[model samples]
Target: MTDAILRMRGITKSFPAVKALQDVNLEVARGEIHAICGENGAGKSTLMKVLSGVHPYGDYSGEIEFDGEPCRFSGIRDSERRGIVIIHQELALSPYLSIAENIYLGNERRGRFGLIDWNRTNADAAALLERVGLRENPVTPAMDLGVGKQQLVEIAKALSKEVRLLILDEPTAALNDADSRHLLDLLRGLRADGITCVIISHKLNEIRSIADSTTILRDGRTIETLDMHGDGVSEDRIISGMVGRELGHRYPERVHDVGAEVFRIEDWTVHSPTQRDRVVVDGAALTLRRGEVVGLAGLMGAGRTELAMSVFGRSWGARIGGRVFKNGEEIRIRTVGDAIAHGLAYATEDRKTYGLNLIESITRNVSAAGLGKLAKAGWVNDNREYEVAERFRREMNIKAPSVLAPAGELSGGNQQKVVLSKWMFTDADVLILDEPTRGIDVGAKYEIYSIINTLAEQGRAVLVISSELPELIGICDRVYAMAAGRITGEVSRADATPERLMQYMTQTEEASP
Candidate 1:
């Protein structure tokens, strides 16, 4: 602690209705990879924001010391000048701008005349991309790259600044396993280069592998900092500090009583919406039984989202060929309205974009999908809407001051709850949830799992698509694996394992003839 490169003491920040951070303390040693662990709304992000000047000096009462000098930063630029840079969980990049342009956006490279030097900018960007292990062209548009590569671009942007202390907020939350590994390796290399790093992540295994020490926070207060190499510092131990209780089981236990098949998709084939010649889903078939929680497992680009979107009223692809069956009766569903009319609901993975309206009030968002049920003569019953939203808010345990609050005001976990409540309000017989627990803490994930169990217990069919294998094995009664746009295999819960599911997920040939 004496050789700490950065120290924050007695940090307290508050908003209108809530006090976010309360006397939080943090210390990061020079060139060590330190991690911050906490549940959602636990003040981890707020503390980092306060340090990086997103909250500014006067907004929070705290003493910040960087490199043994007391500092008061009024803005993000002020912190950047002091060699501190932060990359938020939701990446901030201009999608239309080229990689070089995005990297040198505010910190532009200039020539003798103080005009932008395009040649130098691109060359420098290319070098930084290489340093981050991104083999992308500097002139390529930011939108052309996937989430993983975009993360690397964000890091390259940080490197553009002469950053001494790097702070990453859930950098690997959206990445696949391979991409997550590559980013972690890059962080290790950066640590070796004597650049201190503070990473906020929910992935405990990654923290154990990369971080030198970890600080746990709960309810806006610092719990404790533990040495990662200590004799008994395990993931469960970290969870204990984060949630303030011994988390006996990561997943809640559920009774499985799967019933008759209620929904089925047969001979499903979908071509890419942009690329007509490319097949995104080929002859994919799946079934959902009443009172069952089924899982769809796949790697990135394996067409899990594509299949779900396409089946939900052809919202994704073209040249779609599929037959929908409900109780042995073939039905036609060619639009979202039609799908909803047929008792189907889809909770998207990108909740910010596709699920709930951020600017809309919580009551409105909850009643949006089920307006017809609360409508009379094409006018929504505002009183009924409020009643329904309050019911869901209490049932789902969404933390908010009031149902009139905007959906955007809630944290990630609360926002996800709103999304689920939106779909649940529709009384759909079958629900397709894509990455339901993405970017949420372990405690929130358990709550989501319990909600899914409650849904199944109510005799609703549920299809869960996720990138995490353990999640599928833990809560699902049966799982289907996809690879190369084809269903490779299906396994019952009793027979499912990460290794076995991985074998099925990596297969190139279709499981079905």
Candidate 2:
């Protein structure tokens, strides 16, 4: 009903080898939340870049209008000057800077003679934090905060600019449910203040919750934009639009019959590596049958990652008190080396940090986890390594020019494939995948799902940990729900639902600070 605040027409962009966009059109009504939905490499980011001046004028073929006026953006500053701010998927904060300092990095409050006023900076930062629903003190250094908190800091920084148009790319990819819900509420508050927003997210549920309209992009082409208040505004339709195909199910179907119990955990507990007398995981127990994909479902920090990591190699937390069993025989997994030898491999959730060597080539990264297998007498057989890496690269359908492509150069989906390739070569009977497709796109997600289904069909006991309930239910034969570091319930795949998992994910102590 309101005049369109932002209009983009005939947006076409190209990279050297790829035609990134093709005559895309988009419009956002003033003060309404507009969502861009696409699988990875869907030109969602590229489109946002064009709008925010990240690509600037002439670099891409696009026409843009703001508030009935045509403008050319040479750079980000040009757009920022008009109250347009973009928050990238990766947060851009100085680790050493205080929250106040980071928020006011470019535009500091000035006193006489252009001197910085520390008092006004902190006070204003606190006000911005309050506006964004962050309770942390402004004086705290950025490094000390968790990722969810850092995201709030980013929002406060945007508020400091008196922003009129805000762009958030995968804002909740790294947040817990509570933080995610809080952030969505904050966005609603910002909308109430007449700020136009464009959100790029893979989470359709979140998009349905907050958006006034949704635009689906597939391979850089804009599909139909759906009205949020319309009758057909559902997940299946949005996914269909994004991928240009019917997604029968969000997860690939697995046909493996649950066999004999191959992996078991009993009376498992892990203490915090630091901070004495703090329990991270407590009294957890599970059983995994051969050829079954079992999901670990829980909210972030509900001890899902902690339990997987500790069980894999005692690699996380301290004062470990857990017993792991293989084929009903208790095994000692004192180290990562021990875990691998005993047919266990854990693909970490944080691919850039604990999962892969980002700077290395894909071939090197693939075989890094199990170099011992690809080497002879402590010397890596280069030819054998190449063969192994190339085999998995083709098998995984990793999108790169060749195996020698730098791991960092690939998109998030490709990076995840490299991580899976690393663990696949380890020859582990039990593979624990933590958030395997967290930041990937839709097309890439299909490939990952197929690979997982293949693993289960091959009789590997797979333990999958996912924050997305649909993902867990779609892929796994059985789902294990956790709350407060304890196994609360297990659901058969036939009955597994987000509503059910959320019940357990939300159950918590009635008397906690």
Candidate 3:
């Protein structure tokens, strides 16, 4: 422990009905990229909150030693003063504000008259941006940048704080392959400069690639810490430590009994909502059979989402021309309600923003899409609503104290289950699940896959959109590759491979033409 920069001894935190952490201990070296791996709700984030003062010194039982000095932080500002910064999974930056303004938001440069010093702030932000490999102007609005660039801006903001022990919570969960690599490389650069970093992520491959050492947490307890280089740790070993069992198969076994075509789209064309002249989805067609789980595989901007949204009551596109068929009969879905009435439900990719009402309770969110069912002659029965939500909560195995808990308080997996409960309550025959298992742990992913299997077994037509090819291959009976708003190729489950999917995903327009 002589060279350890951060030491967390016997940390224990509890909420109203749950013990989030128990006797958690962590030691981070001075300049190493240490990783914290665990399933969702395993108390990894809770530990970091305690360290960063989000939980405060008195709220938790822990002894924290930084640079061999015992420290008790009462608030985030107190931790920041000692160069301890934590960047959360959801970024904290105002979209309308300029990059420079956001970087110096709380700690501003004041002039002689106690006025903001704009020139120095811009110059400082520019330097920090260059260090983080973001080339955008300091005066540019944060909304103008992409998700990857915005991540860099967040890192630059931490750099402005002179952060020594930087902590990142699932930083690459939303980034693409290229951006993820860049961010990992940037972490290496930070380590080279003698800054210690602690990263929490579910992506094991990334942890294997960059992490010098890894700490595994399971059920709010520290399982073990392994030196990645010294022990030559494999992914399977890490999985066993995380899940507490040997996972023989990456995906659960499924018996496919595909039925006749139940849903089909023909000559679907969608124009960009903002740029009406630009075509987003052009002449796209696909079919989903009853008792089938189909996948839409594509790159980040391949219009898979556009195609799904455009077909679902024209919710996304401006000028949409599509012919949707249900049970071999043409249907007109001009609105979300029309789509729901026509036996269709779409679980959006962004659950926090579009899927679930964060401030609302789980019961309310689960019953949101099927409120009409609880109504009797325009009057909702409170007893029936509670019973219905309770049934779904029990069926979904949502981990919460009660069905009335706020959706925002639940972890990513529970929030996803709530979203699923909402759609399942709608009882739609055709379900479009976009990024169903994104930002969730492996255990939660298995549960979600089981749910998908149940839906398929019930003869529901399910279409999944995923950036992770392995997930698509594991769950889907057939996979359709989309590129430039068009279906490039379709492959059966027996012949799908990551390489084959990538070939179709990146197929050139000229070749298709």
What does candidate 2 score in Cα RMSD to the true structure? 2.8
Among all candidates shown, the one with the greatest lDDT: 1
lDDT of 2 by residue, 1-513 (tens): 559988899999887768889999998999999999988778999998988898879988879998878878999889888888999989999999999999999899999999999999999999998888888899999999998899989989988888999999999999888888998999999999999989999877899999999998887898898999889788888888877888886666667777899999998988888865888787888999999999999877789999999998899988888688899999999999999999999999999998888888998999998989877888999888989989988898888888887898777898998898888898888999999989887667888999888888888999999988878887888888888877877888888888877776777741111
Quote model 2's TM-score.
Answer: 0.93
In model 1, residue pairs whose N, Cα or C atoms come closer than 3 Å (at least 3 residues apart or on different chains), thus clashing, are none
Off by over 4 Å in 3: 510-513
- lDDT-superior candidate, 2 or 3: 3
What is candidate 3's lDDT per residue for 93-186, written digit by digit as tens? 9999999999999999889899999999999999999999988999999999888989999999999999999999999999989899999999
TM-score, ranked from best to worst: 1, 3, 2
Question: lDDT, candidate 2, residue 389?
Answer: 85
Ranking by lDDT: 1, 3, 2
TM-score for candidate 3: 0.97
* Residue 220 displacement in candidate 1 (angstroms): 0.5
Candidate 1 deviant stretches above 4 angstroms: none
TM-score for each of the candidates: 0.99, 0.93, 0.97
